[model samples]
Target: MWADPNVRAVLVLLAFAAAYVLYALIWPFTHCGACGGGKRTAPQSQGRYWRKCGRCGGTGKKIRLLARMFGRNP
Candidate 1:
């Protein structure tokens, strides 16, 4: 049974599938900036969760934080 062509094909497909699964689990992010620069911006707070802001390139407005801390309107 192991020598059968169909079984070999199935095994090869399963091996590839397993490898892909492992790769995906280890690196879930597709556009992760782990490469050069690696300078990521702050995320915006949404109730409790903070999502990456596209407008500011993921960097939340720092000035806004300072203004709020100083009791000024942002």
Candidate 2:
């Protein structure tokens, strides 16, 4: 079974999926990519005015996509 290429691929993918789910459950929040968790971003040009991050909406944290899909919202 382990010698088969298809089997190895499937096992690797399954492990990855399991790790992703575990991560989603453990740490459901990730840094705001848009503002780098600073909670502020310039909405207009280069540093014109610091405002709330559009992605995380100023909370500085964004719920993981997997968490949202699993009905986790906080």
Q: In model 1, where do residues sit more than 4 Å from their true spots?
A: 32-74
Best by TM-score: 2
Clash count per candidate: 1, 0
- Tens-place lDDT per residue, model 1, 1-74, is 99899999999999997776666555433433332123343455333323454544444333333334445442
Candidate 2: worst-modelled 10 consecutive residues by lDDT: 40-49
Question: What is the TM-score of each predicted model, taking all chains together?
Answer: 0.42, 0.76
Q: Could you give candidate 2's per-residue lDDT for residues 1-74 as a string of tens digits?
A: 78999999999999999999999988999998888876464556565436777777777788999999998889
Winning model by lDDT: 2
Pairs of residues clashing in candidate 2: none
